[model samples]
Target: VDFPLRGEWIYLRSFGHHPHAYDFVKIGNNRKYYSNGNLLSYIFGRVPANIFYCWSAPVYSPVAGVVIKANDGWPDNKVVNLASTIILWVKATFLFRPAKDGPDLDIRPNAGNYIMIQSESGFIAFMAHMRSGSIKVKTGQQVAEGQAVGEVGNSGNTTMPHLHFNLFDQINDPYQAKVIPFVFRSFERRNGNNWESVQNNTPKIKGEAIRKQL
Candidate 1:
């Protein structure tokens, strides 16, 4: 619970858009948590083509742990509209495996490209849907926070390119992960230049926006 916030480059959007809207999942309306379960690389904003190919950037380590699972060969799927959710799910189920870290899965077997950090707090951090062959760390290798592990990408059962990040108490039973609420040691809010701190934060929803000090 006392670790540094790992993500900075990526902004967020659509917080708490899913059913489990909460401080850990959504700040207002933006979906803060990863579709599969990894911390994001960027926040949601009008970055132009950034949404499509932006995830190719590297993902940093939230904590130090060995690489438990990773797969990056999969490609990003197109974003889905509200009406086609059922059809998407059906197709995904037939073609992909369920998300290993949550009940509502957005990842598949091998979890695309990912890294698992076994925090000193006895928590395992899972970052998934990484770019193909972008992983920098290896299994059993020790990594430091903010260490480059892989690039964000759309893979597995994900709809687009985005880092799926999460902290798990156990890697074996990912579905039982207890969403740990946290904040950054230093970040700006509302575009302020000063480095500020945040806690128990969620992402901004559609139509709502906020800026953080980077």
Candidate 2:
């Protein structure tokens, strides 16, 4: 399978921390947010969704598969204020709902748009935090690898636009589904101002910028 995101210089961060260590969530940005140059914006300002470089970037299918589930039409979380965004995130943590998409989805403030594709091998590919109304595929539809599925967005509990991707053994059940790990066939990692080629491996640290290939 190929990486879901298209383009170069994309920022990739693996939650080498706890709980999320297996999930691959890519976060892209137009520029550095926390640094000597943008400390105020990083700490106090409300950052608009468009300011994120990955906000509307196309998300491609890493493998040819039939879509098993597709959730859409949730509005992008606008930047009303930093406080409001945090409040929403906090609210979602406590209101857990069934993993499937349904009307009760709103009860979980962080439950955003998502899609699940079942590969021929029966492996389920899951992607979340997709842009509202940007999903191009529907359930029971077969798709080819590299096909555009949707665009990344700041949905769910995310404070900024990003893509939450993973592979599972089952669909419509996160509690029972087992996460499967995968490595990129080829890609480049950012090292200072240069890009270093990575083969048959995955990034494990935060703030690691990577691309499909050099």
Candidate 3:
């Protein structure tokens, strides 16, 4: 699958991280400035949800496939304070653990609004933390690669607005599904003062900006 969003986006909770290393990978696409930017466009003491540049940014399908699941009902949560955000990161990094129960495991609420598409190659592509009521596709709908499916939001267990993407082997249950590693066709990496091109490499660090090559 190709990079799901366009323009320069920082990689966070990316590969090799706790939650991402185990299953999901996250990308932060919006910035106050294109190159060197602040956390929010305009900081008014506390960063509000709408102040985030990524909030409601269009999200696309990474692969041509049939939608296996689509959810879009929950409202986006308010952006938390810096301390709360830090605490969340600590909890996710050290205290988070996947449920061991097989059939009884529940992950829907935690995932919030999302879309799951089964690629022609058979792997399930999952995108979570989408904006409420922004999903444009439905279950069983056919979608092409790069098709706009929804918008980014601060839903689910997130501290800010960003895209949470993952690939899985199973579609029936998220808890039962095993994560599958995938690579982008091509992407741009942020260099010291410029963006560098990278081919077929997975992003690994926070604040690494990447632009998808169409």
Candidate 4:
């Protein structure tokens, strides 16, 4: 598979060998700094969705496939501060209990707005945390590889803006499906102030900036 977005981005939660908390091997991409390498462009205050560089950036299809599911209409949540973020995490972990077998497909909003495309190889490519109403394709629509499908957003149970990409075997019951490992064909990695080119590498560390080699 190819990198889904353009420009420099940081990989947050990526696993190469096994699935993470949700039983699906997912990759979370985010762009925190601006072009000038400034981590924070403005003084710390209420961080809106626009402050994040990856917010609303075009998301492309990683593979040629048919859109099996295209869900939207979820409002993007506000960006919370560090303290509030910790509290929210604590509450979600201790106070509120989630379903052990995963959320029901009919009522679960865990992924917020998302798109799932079944590739020609029979693997379903899932993209989540998309901007509300930004999906460009519909269910049953065929999409070519690298085609624009949506934009990254700060939706769902996220503290900031990011794109969550994953692959699953079962389309109807995604949480119960087996995760498939995949790698980018070509990409760039962060090396201090410079971006280094890498091929067939799985980005798994936080603060690691990378971009699609185009």
Q: Which scores higher on lDDT, 2 or 4?
A: 4
Please identify which of the two predictions, 1 or 3, would achieve the higher TM-score against the true structure. 3
lDDT of 2 by residue, 1-214 (tens): 6778765544444323123223333443443542122445645876667666566778888789899888788778865356765666566555446553352233224547888899888888878878888899998999998899998876766666778777787855555778777776677887888788888777666666777731
Q: Compared with the true structure, what per-residue lDDT tens digits does model 4 show for residues 78-173?
A: 654555556544554445433543344632245668898999999888888788889999999999999999998866665567787878877676
TM-score of each: 0.58, 0.79, 0.78, 0.77
Question: Residue 49: error of model 3 in Å?
Answer: 0.7
Q: Which residue pairs show collisions in model 4?
A: none
RMSD of each: 8.5, 3.9, 4.7, 5.4
Clash pairs for candidate 3 = none
Best by TM-score, which number? 2
Which structure is stronger by lDDT: 1 or 2? Answer: 2
The Cα error of candidate 3 at residue 69, in Å, is 0.6
Which 10-residue window in model 2 sums to the lowest lDDT? 14-23
Which candidate wins on lDDT?
3
TM-score order, best first, reads: 2, 3, 4, 1
- By lDDT, is 1 or 3 better? 3
Per model, state how many residue pairs clash.
Answer: 31, 0, 0, 0
What are the runs in model 2 whose C-alpha is more than 4 Å off?
9-31, 34-42, 99-109
- Per-residue CA lDDT of model 3 for 1-214, tens digit only, reads 7778876576666323434331222343434342122445323345666656677878889899999889788677765456656665665555666454455443444566889899999999888878888999999999999999998887766666778888888867655778878788788887877788888777776656677654
- Model 3 regions more than 4 Å off: 14-45, 86-106
Positional deviation of residue 71's Cα in model 4 after best superposition, in angstroms: 0.4
Reference-based TM-score, model 1: 0.58
